[model samples]
Target: MEKTTSLISKKHYPILDGLRGVAAIMVVAFHIFEAHATSHLNQIINHGYLAVDFFFLLSGFVISYAYDDRWSKMTVTDFFKIRLIRLQPMVIMGMIIGAVCFYFQDSVLWPTIHEVPIWKMLVVMIIGFTLIPVSLSMDIRGWQEMHPLNGPGWSLFFEYIGNILYALFVRKFSNTALAILVFLSGCLLIHLAVTSPNGDVIGGWSLEPTQLHIGFSRLLFPFFGGLLLHRIVKLTTINNGFFWASLLTVIVLAMPRIGGSKHLWMNGLYDSLSIIIIFPLIVFLGASGEVTGKYSTKICKFLGDISYPIYITHYPLIYIYTGWAVGSKPSFQEALPFALLTLIGAILLAYTCLKLYDEPVRLWLKQKMLTYKPAFITVK
Candidate 1:
């Protein structure tokens, strides 16, 4: 039941693309509600953290499908260059947005923002533009995030690691080896998720070791699981794929917290099962089908297009919204309007960056950085 595409003619998995957009929006909602709760136990979008895992999974699958076969013409350098071209522009824009909104986010959460010199903040933003994680001592905003200005850049940081790993080594592994790697990583992921103090896989932003552990645990499994899934996929047709797949994605993400604090492992079990089992199924179904009608096609295409921009760009606004929510202590009913505005603002901002900055930068990079062909055929 696997869908086939010729090596020359790349197939578009619009449903997967749309599912990614669904996950991205779910992340925005999760962040919007995240400020109200002190812990993962009470967050309204209880499983929203899983969206990162979903994203890693999706990236693995898409990367494998897109590049696994192109090693002949493409070198590791070429691949990295292309990836930076595709992703780094938005990374820079997200950081810039954070800086632009920095003064406005001066709240209890970042009480010392007024004290942080603009030159220092600019230095951090410049480092962030390179996607480098800074130490806590150098953390200007005091959130301990690798990229304080744009929190989600941590995921993109690990994403770059995944890309480097794939380029250097993982791509050379046999399917059996990849499966073994996936298995070991899955066991570690399950252990980390289940045994977490908060009963979730909701970390990896800081430079500290524990956060690094949480981050890698979250990264390795779904990402390698996705790589393995792509390797062993048996795609089957699904009717109305865009709707059903998107629905399933939202439901999995928006589910209530699985286990209460007393039973943290219960939620851990849920998180592990969702990551290990359910997400791959969703990905399979998404890949099995295509968008049919003009509207569905357009919806999927637009969603897919804006998904990355929105996910990367929206979180800085979340920092602002979360700060406001925490400081003002408004009821959900009262804050709904601002939350809605934040959501709309994020979308508009991402779309604007996409049109005005990201697209042009990537086009220029493709022309200048990625135009040269590899001189030697060195397929490992």
Candidate 2:
């Protein structure tokens, strides 16, 4: 006789969830600040882009914790199904939101926005639904972003790559081999950060060779390093881990650019060190933490829930805000109220999608796709 088995749901690290929410909020602030600043060096929330790196670290750790031991029962197809159910609903909603708001974002900043036809925009939106990046030749926004409809979708593109890599090969590696790969990737990241003319790990949105290098460099080390960290380091209990970890996250992401224009490498060093050292520490702390009270637990739950929705959905609004700022040429003080409104509006919209669209769709997908019948084998 054979027995049927069901996969057990994994426990979540609430502190990590809370930290993710904190980082997501900072990303919104970073983009909002991007409208006022002329360049990377002068931008407020200077290191906010590093939130993406921090996210990758979190993703690797979470994925490992969730799936590493399940391969005995989980097929690759099942793994992809779970990821898609968890992630794709929001991605589709983000593209639809982008397409809906595309024309309204027309401004002198994006000169060709007015010239692009509706059908072309729809084509881009449809492509975006699939998350296969469009080449610059097809770019409608003039930003050369992989997904013109949703610019930040570029990171999701790399995110898919990471997932594929993990499912296919990295999942099978020994801890020692994994550590070697992580070390080499770390070197590449440091080299890219220090040597780039911009002096940061910022350029992963485009299709060009240089940008591709930056994208992979941004993706590899922290992701695999997080995996390595999971395999090697044992978790320890910590008091108030969420508060300290969140404080460190905010400080690292909000710090001023180091070295200025003359010593760009200093900022590069900061980026490298933050990714290679500080981000892992934050994850470790978060993983080791416990959500102590009802208030704290609820706060963590709310933030964690909205983190991805807000990050994926807010940029379309930012496009509109950027257009208004550029065409009106408003001072920072003049733009302040609108910026606050934009931030508030984004949070509201994200929450609405979470409740009305993402949750329902994901639930439906899980019911439809994930309800696989158990397979039984002959007893020995």
Candidate 3:
């Protein structure tokens, strides 16, 4: 297989971008359905948590493709600035959205929501905007999530760690060295996933030591594996790229929970194999295919545009929906209409933030902070 020098030189992979959007949508669905169930065993979208792994893989591949060759021209500060520009705006918006929806989310699970002062929530939201994880004592919400305002912010925190590691260390490693790192991370991931009492790799939101282990275990392998895949794989031209890639992505994400409760390792094997093997295939096919029709191209572009915004912002609403569902214990048939409405509301809210807040904030930041010209890198 021939190796390519830079993702900077290649055209944007529209299908991969769309696949991200698809995965983001699936996450929203998963969270909605998650509200209706007591545990992963009964959750409708049992495998939806794997979407975070998918996001890490996609981020790694894109980072490698875009920056692997530009490190010589780019300083570490510039790279950090670029990443912050791309990500922090959404971080801020997600937190603000969470804060705005926080009071409305009061329920039995978060009974103290009524007692926590507004200034405290604002303080939490302000800290959250910086992408800093708070300790449990400062946790305004009772959930103990590192970012109580927006639970999904934990992934972004790890993503920042990955970026720092890439800038300071990983980028310097040879392919063999990087492969060893990925291998070790994969082993850790498999062990963590299999051994967890829940029979899945889903417990990374809290601030405890064990949850920290889960967070890193989830982040390292797929992110570095993606970087490795970009370094090694030959991209073949493929047809109906978005359709097939999205279909496979949905299948993997929606796959029934493996091994059930009796055999936890069985599910762990499923998680590890999917990340190690299947995800890279999806990225390859997505990168190799083109958006053929005008309508398809538009759809992919829209999906790609909203993917990050949706993922980051939708969970606060999930907190609200979860509170409502837990209080009512509504049947799926009864909840379906409101669930559909929640999905629509989340999308509309994401689009609104994208246009009104995120886009303009990023544009202004780029003008003020991006002193060095970024080498062309397509962001999904």
Candidate 4:
């Protein structure tokens, strides 16, 4: 039999770490250039916001692939405990950091906060602090449940939801049905994002919990897309890394056409294309072992490791940095330096926090959490 490359074949792939590095940098470029055209040449960096969608698509596949089987076989308490360890500790630290920044800065997080009350603020804070996904939106004395401090934080809630749903349903249905549900979710999200006519999403202003009604609908697709892709590729043993690499290259080259004519068609095409391409490339590079090479991967893995913290904390920093640079006019000579400094600064801060909270918390949780059931436990 011909040897086939499989992400499933390996337990750890550093190239995915490298890919994480790339994806994180793409987001940094996208945000660094926010709304300001550096030059027509700068569009590549500017348009990198697509990276976040790519991250979501990738996350859907990765987190699910990593956790699904574990959840399926483990006891409920074990399942929740593993998830808590995997995600919550660092996430809560991020929330605390964000809250501190919000309190100190008194500025908006992503220009999303219009009016948030003390009670609603308490709820969002408490939910974030406790790491629960609360889309149960309500008006308590005219206050609303919203995600105020960090816009990216809400995605974690949906992530946890996806994990639970997969664990519950994966054992009961055929793969086909699961695929259909996930694909439909992606379609619904695209429809909602574009259908507004004005292009403003439902919670355009803030990362409000209410935004998640549609947002959850939107994220469902990518998460499922990733998970399904992993299962299929692993089962079929599709090993042609070149095929995926070429596809991603072409997609990146063709990105110039994104957000243009045939808007919906083009948008969906690239979005889907990215996921298909990036994940395999990730697997391939990991198998190749190039990601561990001297100098580059070292820095990249470091960046990748710290990505979550930087992502959560950078928004406040960006707002402040941009606001400060507003008067400086920030010429081309200064742009690169400023951007580099901002990115580096965010990375360092994240690294410190990761050491303080992320790693220790993950270790403790893994050691203490319940694990997947071995075959002996089930009478299969």
Best by lDDT: 3
Ranking by TM-score: 3, 2, 1, 4
Across 91-173, the per-residue lDDT of candidate 3 in tens digits comes to 99899889988866668878455689888988999999998899999888888899999999999999999989998999999
Quote the lDDT for 126 in model 3. 95
In model 1, residue pairs whose N, Cα or C atoms come closer than 3 Å (at least 3 residues apart or on different chains), thus clashing, are: none
Off by more than 4 A, model 3: 1-9
Specify the poorest-scoring 10-residue window by lDDT in model 3.
1-10
What lDDT does the true structure give each of the candidates? 0.85, 0.88, 0.89, 0.54
Model 4 agreement with the true structure over 1-380: per-residue lDDT tens digits? 32322223325444455455556655665666762554333345533544544555566556545655653345556556656666677677766765655545533223323354555656666777765544536222121334455555655666667667766665344579877876677567666655533232323212454465655654566667666666665432334432343345334533543465335454545444444455445543333444334765475457558666666666655655655455466776777788888888777777887788777877676545534422211000
In model 4, where is the ten-residue run with the lowest total lDDT? 371-380
Please give each candidate's TM-score. 0.94, 0.96, 0.96, 0.71
Question: Cα RMSD for candidate 1?
Answer: 4.9
Error of 1 at 18 (Å): 0.8
